[model samples]
Target: MRSQQFLIFLLILKVNLKDVLLGFGNLKPGLKYSVLIFAVALPVMAYGSTLSDFSQYYPIWKPASDSTWNFILYESAIAIRMLATEFFYRGFLMWTLMEKMDERYANLIHSFVYMLMHIGKPPLEVPYSFIGGYVFAWVDLRSKSILPSFLIHFLGSLVFDLMIINQVFICL
Candidate 1:
């Protein structure tokens, strides 16, 4: 499991590197776009960190007894699960929806659906997910690429899952 997680992470890293290399000349423009992206992201992330119960919405601990192997397997499973989610939500869903409507409208609808997907989780998570969806959608729109959103989502999920597995956060 440890190997698998490491391998997946490496694969993502490689792809991102390739993209960076291919788009080196566009870095300045991309960074300019990312400014708006981060402007939207920062405040939400800051506010989210302040909630005492925010952690409850995430899975923060491993279900199995203490063991390195178990931890690796659990975390790896989480990474894989989140990767699939990114593919569905940010990749397929966003692309398909965008094709059917203007970017703004598509983003709004996509964010709403993304929030709906979290309905069964913690009550707080419902709102959080909605906000997160909007932020991610904005990033996608501004960057004109899904890569930025995917990176953010992947990292966020990693931290959320690690917090859950470590018992730093409890699920509702």
Candidate 2:
């Protein structure tokens, strides 16, 4: 049987993917903003990753083997989760709460929830996620697509993972 992580990833993948495709696809519009937000956030996340002891808390799945398939499967799951997370925060939330109420409130609510998700994480990251989440939500609000937000979330997370691993391996 697939592990619990894979199962959760599957569920998220199905729901979030459907929402993005059905709700507000046509990703062309958000592509430019995605690149811009990602580029803008990359360096900051990189710097923050270095400052925080992220390696201690992340990459939950360790290498089972050095085989290519092992890395592919692991990273692919990570990528899926990143996409799913952003879709929920930036896409689903935007459609639901933002549609019902003003977008500013929706963004704040999303950011607060996003921040809460980081509670067990490093102290710095907890607050950072809220602020960063707001920025991404705002970007989505402006761009009218979650594409840019997804790109930023995924790339930012991947970069942090890389930084954490790099710091560990370099020191050893």
Candidate 3:
């Protein structure tokens, strides 16, 4: 099981890197602005952190020493995982499925799977992902790339993580 996993891991990494390079090369100013404007809603993003806190899951452990190397490794793993998710859902799910079906229908199917993937987490997040998944899919379609979605997903989760850390830190 572990040996086969490496090949899949490498395949996914290659695909994501290819899309990222191409997506960055072809990126437009409008998408940049959309992300910038979207970022103004950090407080709204904190809602998920609130739910996490209520569920008593706040404050993922940090590096004991705040070492730069530790931070890089930790954040890089998260970024890679987040990018993999965006590529799978926004890139492959939207682009690949659109070939065999209507775009709207493809997005709907993608949304269903996206939400289903969120199962076993907090219940509130399940429905939220359904709605957010469609929006991310639509954005990927319009932007013609998964880069924006990756940025949004990555930074949005970062914000939530920071929110939880801040709350925990302040209390301590």
Candidate 4:
């Protein structure tokens, strides 16, 4: 089963190898990239704490009652979901909207769309998602790359998942 999965993954990877390589080639190196990454991540980390506090209002929002292995799998799945989300929202939607409108307007639209995407999530989460989307859109606009937003989104999700885990364990 593992081998089959690995083979399928490798096959998919091969198809996107050129785009992946080219994307990396286009990334700016050195201090500027590092600073942008920090700028993106630090706000998420700060705001994530507030989200964690807000999660307290929803006692049912904890992670599933699963084994360690299951939790790891869940975390991995969340990470993958976050990556796909960034690709869809920040990469595709933001890029397309920016092409059609001015930068400020596009970013506003992106943030609003991003907030709408979270309609099914807990109410407390919507505001943070809006703030995050705006920050990420701004970062993409200023940095001229999606990499920083991607990192920020991934790390933010990881932190949120961890918070869920902690809440679950505390309730136990």
Candidate 5:
């Protein structure tokens, strides 16, 4: 599953793997921007977690239950999935679109598609996904790589899972 999009991007699109994944030029700015955006997002995510019962929807941590090893495995898998997702959205889609059109339109297209993917998730999340998607695309464009957005997505998801766990197991 992870290799499919990458293969398409490489073979079909003829995009260089490094250009899409590692990007060209300096990456420090993207890294810093990712950190700053996440810092701001933490509080918003925290509050959003309170607005909905995420456990009913995701239940991602439920399968692991009480096993520490299982939890680690789940998180690892999620991180890998996020990597693939970023590659597809930020790397494949955006880069391909940018080749034919303006960067803004390409990014907006990417953001819309990105948001659509979150439709079945939490209600609040569906709407904000557009905003988050746009920001992530912007960060990827600025950094010229998907690494920064990948980190943000993976870490934010991990934190949200923890918050849901707290609400499900600890608070209740």
Candidate 6:
């Protein structure tokens, strides 16, 4: 669902996959900055699930059984979903906004829209989504690619799921 805009843009612009995934010329700054961005986000992700009752919202821990293959598949699906989300937000929306306006305004608009999309999420998450969205947009704009934000978002989601699984199922 989230990837529809990205797909439509790709069709209209006839943009290539590599350029869309990596962004245009001069990729070094984005690449260099990704390490710092991920490092800073690591600890936040470590404690993310503890911030709210995400399990009540997602109910994913019910399937955290000893089935390795099932767990792998679940995580894989999450990764794909997160990727699609990042592409939609940081890739399609951000870049399209940048084309029409200044980068800072684009980031703000993108962050607001991103936060709005989190309206049905855990209560605490809805407000914080704006901050996280802005930060992710900054990283995407700096790196000129959604890959960095995608990595952070995907790993953060994975960590949140793992933490919930560990607390609800494993630790029980």
Candidate with the greatest TM-score versus the true structure: 5
Show the lowest summed lDDT stretch of 10 residues, model 1: 17-26
- Tens digits of per-residue lDDT for model 2, 33-61: 67776777777777776764665666667
**Which residue segments of model 2 deviate by more than 4 Å?**
1-29, 64-69, 167-172
TM-score of each: 0.59, 0.71, 0.72, 0.63, 0.87, 0.78
lDDT of 3 by residue, 15-87 (tens): 5534422265345743764576466656566666667432355223366124445545766777878777877
**lDDT of every predicted structure (CA atoms):** 0.58, 0.68, 0.65, 0.60, 0.80, 0.72
Q: Give candidate 5 regions above 4 Å deviation.
A: 21-25, 167-172
Query: At residue 97, what lDDT does model 2 achieve?
Result: 78
Which parts of model 4 have CA positions greater than 4 angstroms off? 1-22, 25-65, 167-172
- Where model 1 places Cα greater than 4 Å from the true spot, the runs are 1-61, 161-172
**In model 6, what is the error at residue 51, expressed in angstroms?**
5.2
lDDT (C-alpha) at residue 132 in model 3: 74
Estimate, for each residue in 38-147, the C-alpha lDDT of model 1 and write its tens digit: 56656665565456555555445535325556656766776666655655565556666766888678777878999998877656778878777777656555555555
Query: lDDT: which candidate is best?
Result: 5
For model 3 the TM-score comes to: 0.72
**lDDT of model number 2:** 0.68
Q: How many residue pairs clash in each candidate?
A: 7, 1, 0, 0, 0, 1
Off by over 4 Å in 6: 1-9, 16-35, 46-48, 59-61, 64-66, 167-172
lDDT of 3 at 52: 47
